[model samples]
Target: MRLDLGAIAKAGTSKANQTGSWRNFKPIFHQEKCIGCSLCKIYCPEGCVTMVEKKKYTVDYTYCKGCGICAEECSSSDIEMVMEEK
Candidate 1:
């Protein structure tokens, strides 16, 4: 059998997994610094980031792995990675 890597059979599977509890860090979205570039939503590996409005977005902690990719990819320094309290 051949393994098909990087192939997503379905999307939005993270909603059922609730993997945020395993994260050691969390991303904080600072709207004031956001430039509406949508980088965070585009770069999020877990697909937990979603557009809130035309130029705004929000993170869903339920499935966010806190990998910090979104924060690192933000050009305007809108997202910040912080220690997860829980």
Candidate 2:
């Protein structure tokens, strides 16, 4: 017998699973350095980054996978990835 599985994952299903629990490094947002370009939010693969205000952004650790995409994509170099204490 053969099992059939779709190639693409269903949309909005990732929210049900919290993938941030095992991340070794987490992205830190610097309020002062941020230029509010929204690069971090646009590049996040897990869709964990969010905009708090016009020039401010925050990350939802519950769904963030610590992939460093946010930090790399930051136009102002405001996001930093630091080792998780736990």
Candidate 3:
């Protein structure tokens, strides 16, 4: 099966929008591993994690310090800390 390049491009754009500040810091959420628990949101000292909807969370790196607390406290091993590309 051939891949749809347009769809891939759109998906990339959507991911970029969802993950703001791609140049500063990034939070990689492993959805398959995420158990829909809100521990990350609770442990985030910066209060950057927000529930966009039920069972869905987003990190606001615009204020995040890349402290990795979310990744550390994620019982499901879903959250990961990643450095942003310069």
Candidate 4:
């Protein structure tokens, strides 16, 4: 019997995995406190952060792994890391 390796994965396949539950801590954005430095967007490993309007940024939690890189890179202390709820 020949092994059909070609049938393994289909093209443009989407994963059903949700990683938000894996986060120990979540980031809280303080929009008012943000200085529009773009540091959070620049440093985000997952590229979840996006610019909304003229220097303001918004984070998409769907792809965020809660690595805290955004919080660490925030020179204005705009992004705060808080523990995730069970």
Candidate 5:
């Protein structure tokens, strides 16, 4: 079996570069308000939002661009959109 490694596969090149600065807004997750809908995870463009538990999710800010896709897609309004603070 062969592994499908794409893009910068080197550890140095991949870990040294971060992509979180490309956003004008950031998404904040409300654990209490979340309904385990999983919409945020599906709509995240960067795939930074991951389900850490049955009803909880975590965002990897290292690569998240503050896109509001997750917030917009959230039917329960569990994700809130806020301006990114420099």
Candidate 6:
């Protein structure tokens, strides 16, 4: 099936705006350490993290702001904080 690239792009842009602060903060997910509890996704104020697959989660950095809430909320220490270059 053919996909609407323009609609997808627009949706992506809109989602980015919803979490633009995340661009300043990057989330490092340690798969080996992650228990797949999804705590990080639950506590993210920006709601940036989403289930990418069965056991993996993806973080949307566009609005993350490096708040470290995900890291703090992570019970397994799966998520780490890194500096973003402006």
TM-scores of the candidates in the order shown: 0.80, 0.80, 0.63, 0.76, 0.77, 0.67
Compose the digit string of candidate 5's lDDT tens values, residues 1-86. Answer: 45566643545565455788887888888877778989888888777789989889879889888878888888888888788779
**Residue lDDT tens for model 2, 1-86:** 45457556568885788888979999889877888888888888877788999889999998888999888888888889999998
Q: What residue runs in model 4 are displaced by over 4 Å at the alpha carbon?
A: 1-16
Instruction: State which candidate has the highest TM-score.
Output: 2
State each candidate's clash count. Answer: 0, 0, 0, 0, 0, 14
- In the predicted model 5, the residue pairs found to clash are none
Q: By TM-score, how accurate is candidate 1?
A: 0.80
Q: Please, what is the whole-model Cα lDDT of each candidate in the order they appear?
A: 0.86, 0.85, 0.71, 0.81, 0.81, 0.73
Error of 5 at 31 (Å): 0.9
Poorest lDDT segment (10 consecutive residues) of candidate 3: 14-23
Number of clashing residue pairs, candidate 5: 0
| Lowest lDDT block of 10, candidate 1 | 6-15
Return the lDDT, model 4, position 79: 84
Model 6 is weakest, by summed lDDT over 10 consecutive residues, at 7-16
Q: For residues 1-86, could you state the per-residue lDDT of candidate 6 as single tens digits?
A: 56886645444455535455436657787666777889888888777788877667877665666788888888888788777786
What would the per-residue lDDT of candidate 3 be over residues 47-84, giving only the tens digit for each residue?
77898776677787666667778888888888877777
User: How many residue pairs clash in model 2?
Assistant: 0
Worst 10 residues of 4 by lDDT: 9-18
* lDDT for residue 8 in candidate 6, whole number 0-100: 56
- Measured with C-alpha atoms, the lDDT of residue 25 in candidate 6 is 59
